[model samples]
Target: MSPIELNKRQEEILQIVKNNGPITGEQIADRLSLTRATLRPDLAILTMAGFLDARPRVGYFYAGKKSAQALGDTMNNMKVKDFQSMPVVVRESVSVYDAICQMFLEDVGTLFVVDEQSLLVGVLSRKDLLRTSIGRQELNQIPVHIIMTRMPNITTCKKSESLIEVSRRLIEQQIDAVPVVAEEPAGLRVTGRITKTTITRAFLSLSESHEL
Candidate 1:
């Protein structure tokens, strides 16, 4: 089914119902600082549009899976650039131990590996460092480039791409994050990153935007 298009007020109403329902119409109106009369039309539309369900004594409730689907559709329409987080970067020539320290200091699961020109060259995950660190006494002497996932093999997304596509890549690749990049005269330059945490924040923002 085609998703219902909601105006600001309707979205606000749906959000309220999702949070505080099964709540009375009068209560919802009170939260919005509008009279029940003023809110009647919105309530009617939401009920008819299948975004809400009302019970006689219990008040109103969100329409369950349909509401979830609507939120998912909205998220899918949002662009990756709109929600991508700042990337933690390290030079390819940096030692593996130093890179690990940087990752811990920045509190990120992955780090974008870049060249001297700041062009994206590879990607390094915690797993990569862990595998390399085991039984290795020369971690501080080994460059990250030796173990990083190189370009063309690394999953990346452009700023113009949708969040849906980025989320798909995160799941399908079994990776924690994807670098957001732009094509340059020299190579791909890392601008940002989309991670599982970023997606969680996006969901929270979407939910909070509709709150009372």
Candidate 2:
């Protein structure tokens, strides 16, 4: 028999599991305004795709750490590289106020902080901005580098890493987002980004499959 393709509804169901997984079928149905019976097929497909795991009482989770292991298995001894292709980045010199504005304009949660050489020096998030704002500090004088998560310990992902691995890091870190990094002549550089939304979409795509 030919393989089944995921339809739009199946994709939606998959997203629910990825975003708020370990959730109950009933909860999923409720979110979609669907009946349990109506959503069964989508759930079943997601289960088949290895996108979700069902628990007896705890409900369906996003498969938690399994995706990371799967990524390792699939890659075969490859290291989890940093995200270099970050979409939004700002200079360490950029003011918190300006950074906040950029974040809002970009509709992203985090921004990479780059040095004069454009090397990744730190990371800033919406939470950081809010915290800084609470103090009412001088945005123009205060550099984002002061409030950003600095280098070497930054949680990042590479484009080559499997989507599953990326998803795992996002969940485990409990952070809003991650920065992509790449090797540059001067040093490691911020490239792009992979966010919860991206992982959520991937999970949904995996879940919305037809029976084999």
Candidate 2 whole-model C-alpha lDDT, 0 to 1: 0.68
lDDT of 2 by residue, 1-212 (tens): 23445587766776787887668989998999987855654565455445567888878866532222232342332222321223788888888889999999988888888888888888887888899998957887787888888877688777566656766787888876777778778777676777776566545544334333
* Residue-level error in angstroms, candidate 2, position 133: 0.6
Per-candidate count of clashing residue pairs (backbone under 3 Å): 0, 22
| Model 2: residue 112 alpha-carbon error in angstroms | 0.6
User: How well does each candidate superpose onto the true structure, as a TM-score?
Assistant: 0.65, 0.60
Best model number under TM-score: 1
Candidate 2: residue 70 Cα off by (Å):
12
| Cα lDDT of model 1 by residue, 111-179, tens digit | 999999999999999999999999547998899999999988999999888878888899999999999
Worst 10 residues of 1 by lDDT: 64-73
> Can you give the lDDT of residue 129 in candidate 2?
89
Assess candidate 2 and give its TM-score to the true structure: 0.60
**Model 1 error, position 101 (Å):** 0.8
